[model samples]
Target: MGEERECCHHRTKERSEKEYKDMINRLSRIEGQVRGIKGMVEKNAYCPDILIQVAAVTAALNSFNRVLLANHIKTCVTEDIREGREETVDELLATLQKLMK
Candidate 1:
């Protein structure tokens, strides 16, 4: 039997229309880039060319992460701090450490 239950570690955010669209658009572009890489592999493209495309995809992903992290700091982190939720700062630090690694 399949059952749904609330997860203690799971949370959700309500994003603005623009934010939602922006995220989806970015992900779509990344998906397209990955598909292009797959095509390159299938078509026996040059190794260097495929590697370069993979690098581009990595850069795109990092750019997306930067945007998301900035938004999180501006919204979630700021609001949590304002509400005297000091644990949010610790959580932010842990996230930063993970990202750095």
Candidate 2:
């Protein structure tokens, strides 16, 4: 999808086919990891084992975030700035603040 400005202030960013597929694949793996964690809980697996799995999932999510952030900076942020959309920078800063928190 191309950039969409919704009436309710929600925005959408279109991704290239490769980017979209990569994101979807990463999400599917994360979903599987979560389901595995739930299974571990149901099976009464060792606490340490569960914690390790959780950490793996957290790292995977962080990696995904890093990739997505890089893509956004390279594309959306760069394009917006080139087009004289100063507000995009402020929006990015606000997003970064929230991510950091």
Candidate 3:
């Protein structure tokens, strides 16, 4: 259940155990944060307090994106470029644009 971009032309990279664990850990933390936010809403917590927690979750998600993007660029992008697959660069750019939005 890794987050590889499902494409017919692309290949999947097998992440190192450490990398996999780190991503899983980050996702777990984010999941917990979401649950906390749900609890806060259920208990009628203050708006500002709930917003703060929501911001934290967004920050955590951004961090996860950064880590995943860095790894993708380092491994998948590099390999594709080496293999003369110019389309991968376009795909990467498109992905980055979406992320920026």
What overall lDDT goes with each candidate model? Answer: 0.85, 0.85, 0.87
Deviation (Å) of 14 in candidate 2: 1.4
Q: What is the lDDT of candidate 1?
A: 0.85
Model 1 Cα lDDT, one tens digit per residue, 1-101: 47432211225666778988999999999999999999999999999999999999999999999999898888777877777787888988999999899
TM-scores for the candidates? 0.88, 0.88, 0.89
- Deviation from truth (RMSD, Å), model 1: 6.1
- Per-residue alpha-carbon lDDT of model 3 for 1-101, expressed as tens digits? 77754232335657678987999999999999999999999999999999999999999999999999988888788877877888999999999999999
lDDT of 2 by residue, 1-101 (tens): 77642111136776778888999999999999999999999999999999999999999999999998888888778877777787888998998999899
Give the Å error, residue 53, model 2.
0.4
**Model 2: runs farther than 4 Å from truth?**
1-10
Off by over 4 Å in 1: 1-10
- Give the deviation of candidate 2 from the true structure as CA RMSD: 3.8
After superposition, candidate 3 runs with Cα above 4 Å error: 1-11
